[model samples]
Target: MSKGLKGKLVLAISSRALFDLSESHQVYLTQGIEAYRQYQIEHEDEVLEPGEAFPLVKKLLSFNASLGRDRVEVVLVSRNSADTGLRVFNSIQHYELAISRAAFSGGRNPHPYLNAFGCDLFLSTHADDVRSALDAGFAAATILAGGTRRAQSNELRIAFDGDAVLFSDEAERVYQAGGIEAFQVLERESARSPLRGGPFKGFLEALNLLQREFPDDACPIRTALVTARSAPAHERVIRTLRDWDIRLDESLFLGGLDKSAFLEAFAADVFFDDQAGHCERARQVVATGHVPHGISNPLRDLPAD
Candidate 1:
């Protein structure tokens, strides 16, 4: 929504981020929401403690906003029970920080259900849930296996594409489907038109909160936009970011050139793009993510590694 959240670091933590569950405790989660529902019904008045997951959530949240105020948003999602959401929210509030959003599937199958929340990143128990969320639109991961390690730093350097990452993919979709000729015509016609909100808008707002908290003249979290559009087509991108009052540390409009070099020089920790070619190339330089265009890719249908 803010043109792009290129340089911002977004860390998504789940209820599981606060505590660890034993093998027995994990049985209900594995069984899905039905098992959780039964457990809650049996022990209506029982209150669950914030397991080992709570401290990690606090650590990540604190690291994100360490330089200033309200820089991080902890979105609490639960499928354990209705009461589980309240319990997690209360724990977060105990630290004087509120949960950004809450989502519950009421089913033990957390993967399919949590996918609907549109989290930028997901911290949860299921490894498959992390993969699904990443495949959707968010950079998701499980809390275990070093998922939160890379995100521990406050000074995160992130890269994003302009058209789809920040603004709506409507125009880019037209371009990709119709070709350069049609794209130019559309851009010329829509010179005065504004773009719509993107998947990263809410994530950008969260970063803005971080920026406001620090308010340093220099940007602590560096961001860059490596886009294919140039000159005139770039006006909308600039205007949109300015209008939203979002600040980008760096921006490059490379018309038709490859972006791998710029990304390498920037030393970006992660780069996201809808084009597999771009992500493939950027991966050689940084930890890259291929954002599925919500369109089919005939080439990548092979079984997962």
Candidate 2:
């Protein structure tokens, strides 16, 4: 029988997110593909150091040891041509990562394959691919090589930003144009209303399903919603979760506070947010991924408003 992803927790991660390709990336940026390809070929035997999401991926894979089954699947999604990907595969073997599948798209967009793999989450260092994956209705994030921290908890704690992330960018558009006061009024007015599902909603729902597999008190999966909304604004979020029938283990309504210290305390295995500023801040304390979708990232021809 062929292996399938429907019953597993699937993740499609980019080579850049899985391993440190900075030197090679800089070569690609400065010299071009020829040099970069040569560099990768020359260093094919050199194992890669862990990138921001490496630790989290390792921990996630570790769960399989106890489950005695393929409860998780992490697939490599990369822009590297097949010729240049040997180094990455070698590094994966060196690290003994359980990633058995990969999509090498050369220089083209590779995100379109995410769904075929039943990817619950897609993490890449490429912002364009992240946006495209999100637009294509996958839970995607742009992994940054910062805020890689040591996890103190045994549970797989995954945290996410609310607006433009787990929830639609609708409220974010209002806030972006009207500022805090107007946005607060809108949220207050719609306190009873549930926000539309956003890019990461599917991933959250899938994660909840995994949580249900084990006893609540001892589930290996723990999720958090860390957003900038506070008080009167908090009702909609609470109601939305209730409406979705999904329960988050924790929530932080920061309103306007910096999320770094709090996330550090939370010791999140990974944090996802649409805002680069927030991602930058949170990445200093936890593995962070930037969701470059919605109003914040305006495409050349599209109106962000």
lDDT of each: 0.58, 0.85
Candidate 2: regions farther than 4 A off: 1-4, 151-153, 300-305
Each model's TM-score, in the order given?
0.59, 0.93
Evaluated against the true structure, the overall lDDT of model 1 is: 0.58
lDDT of 2 by residue, 149-261 (tens): 77455678888899999999999899889998899999999999999999888889877877787787777878889999999899999999999999899999998899988
Cα lDDT of model 1 by residue, 196-273, tens digit: 756555556666555565557654567788888887788777777887878777889999799888877676656666
Every model: Cα RMSD to truth: 8.3, 3.2
- Model 1 off-target regions past 4 Å? 1-10, 13-65, 68-120, 123-154, 295-305
Q: Cα RMSD for candidate 2?
A: 3.2
Prediction 1 TM-score vs. true = 0.59
Model 2 residue 72 distance off true place after TM-score fit, in angstroms: 1.3
